[model samples]
Target: MAETGTAPSVLYEERSQRLLDQVALKETDRTPFVFATRFWAAKYAGITFEEQMYDAEKSAAALEKVLVLLEPDGYVPSLYIFGPTLSALDYRLMQWPGHGTDRNATFQYLDREYMPAKDYDEYLFDPTGYCFRKYLPRVAGAFEGLAGMPDFPSLSEWRFVGAMRAFGRPELRESLRRLLEIGERAEEAAQKSVAFVKRMAALGFPSAGGGFCKAPYDHVSDFLRGSKGCMLDLFRNKDKLLEAIDKVGELLLRGVVEETRAGGTPYVFIPLHWGLDGFMSPQHFQTFYWPGLRKVMLRLIEHDLIPVVLWEGDCTSRLELIGDIPRGKAVYWFEKTDLVRAKSVLGDTVCLRGNVPTSMLIAASPDEVDEYCKMLITKVGKGGGFILDGAASIPDEARTENVLAMAKSVRKYAS
Candidate 1:
């Protein structure tokens, strides 16, 4: 790998400390640069996305090449789906690696009402049991037999012995065999992910996040109920929906705390999905989205993990609700929200990252990128607690010169 701009001996520590300092609302020598690109890494390494997913070593090498080229202080090393494994299991949530879509197209989630509206009570009563017995079978064809299988506790009951016979059947055995194959392939992909993370850390770019979480409303909307179903639940099944939301929120917080406790890294990535302005009115957002999400943030903060909130869409109207967090305890990465207004509303309470138009990165010249970065750093990076990043992600087709300009500008202006 090419020499990182920071010294090799202290590079990782230096970059990590820079990010931590900004998270703490302390000024650093320069603004820390975080790049969000997944497929672009594959593109940078001159490989198709499918190749990156199947070949662990190749994927790691591709990420390393991108890091060496862009030299961002931090990045997500891998955001790939194990397409072959998912395909093997006949998983229906997403289509990837040209299986059901174009080879060059990014993976698409085939969202549907995986959980029927009628099952709300069942899901609320036992989320784990419902997921295993109800949801999984619907999504993964290999698990269809699982739906008929008795719940584990029922196995101990004398009357349920008949249900146990299903597991011994040839079809169920074949499904189990297919599942094992999927698990093995998933393990391989996970190993590649670990390798890529280690490679990035060794090269001085630490991961921007230590762990991840989803908003409770999104957990219901994206996975269980479809978007339309979730919206309808807000009115039709208000009480049960609220109960389900709280249950999910509790589960999420518990998992995040347990997973992140020993890592020693403070940041947990919380991608805000389906909570933007267009998704719900301000009052509904206040009612359905913010309460559970805020509970999660506060709990994470209590455990000393900084909640890095990636606001995925227009949240301009909900800034006040977000800004309610304790000062310097969160990092808001905005997509379509106005940065200057965000700064005015949230500057004191949280660190801000974001909103460089992806179009600019793909179409603008290097000089143009430089100018835009200058404006962002000068305006938003005025005080401590600002990170420079693309508004969302660096597209696969983003110009290398423009991306480099973003990194170099931080060095030139902010340094």
Candidate 2:
């Protein structure tokens, strides 16, 4: 262990600086190992996934237990969804562990076209009004009553008196009541997350990131248009879709910079979806996806924030296109992308974070795990711009011995 009596504060500063140094493509003592998992920690700590999602304290404790066990160079708080907050808003995007699945199972998202094709103008011109009046009502049960309310912009001047009458609707009143409850749950969830991050810092661990956002195309695809709808829109409604994507990208950049600054961490985590090689053609990626994502990354870099982008799926084809950002100002965490090829292309451009196979951690023996880590260290971790992590995240079923072997391999090989 690197920790000793009254030395946690010292360790925290050292670990934090080491990670920052690696992000700058500078030399470090060894490649940093960051523990990036969600439900796996709950299973490791003998806690049900349901308990971890609903109780912030339990979720933090479960993750804390794993940190003590593995002692990674950097750690992220449990990225588990807050069940009570979702419940309060009657959120309909996904089914959580206990609410919709077995207590031990992870949550699942339901993908459907929540926005119609004809509504692009409404969203592009007045997104806030459209969401409060149409989008939210269509998705969340608590916001269904909002459909009856007048557009907020129309509520100005003497027209406000007439607009106020919309609240008299029985459903709208109920929506207001639920919104109040949702506000409380949201505050509680925020406090719990901040507290957990502080506690981890005190235990000699630095966070992998302080804020998280999605690629703009993902923001549109995952929440508004379903994959099928968004895919078809590439041909059917390309112009409108592109305009909406640009507007959303700008909005996201503003929120990410503000929140990341307030969170007091320089790294902003972005998990990209829908922009992978399998999801779109290379031409489509150049036109629709890469531009918006690149804009956000550049803006984040300008703000002096490092964008820790996780390419969730195999984006091997888009590697060169994605490497156009400024050098040593970002981290690209790959799921299944080839790290050796990535290193050759991006070694001087940015820091590379991962490529470890999750299946091996779940099914392989300790010796096999050690050998794979050794290969990754010598190949990708050479020349000092790599951080060790699992493919995407550490799965809940990963073997304890295999996980331990991976953590230990860093010292044996990188040292």
Best TM-score among the predictions, by candidate number? 2
lDDT per residue (tens digit) for residues 202-222 in model 2: 888778767777788888888
Each model's lDDT: 0.81, 0.86
Backbone clash pairs for candidate 1 read: none
Which residue ranges in model 1 land beyond 4 Å of their true spot? 1-6, 79-81, 155-163, 261-264
List model 1 lDDT by residue over 1-415, tens digit each. 2334556548888888888888878889888788777688788778888876666777678778877777776776555747768778888887776677667667778768889889988888878889877898888888876665557765666667767776887766777888888889898776767666776777677877577887899989988998889999999988888988999998888768877665446778888888998889888898999989998899899988889888987889898887788888889999889888898888888989987788898998999999988887888888878899988868778888888888788888963
Top model number, lDDT:
2
Model 2 misplacement above 4 A: 2-6, 79-81
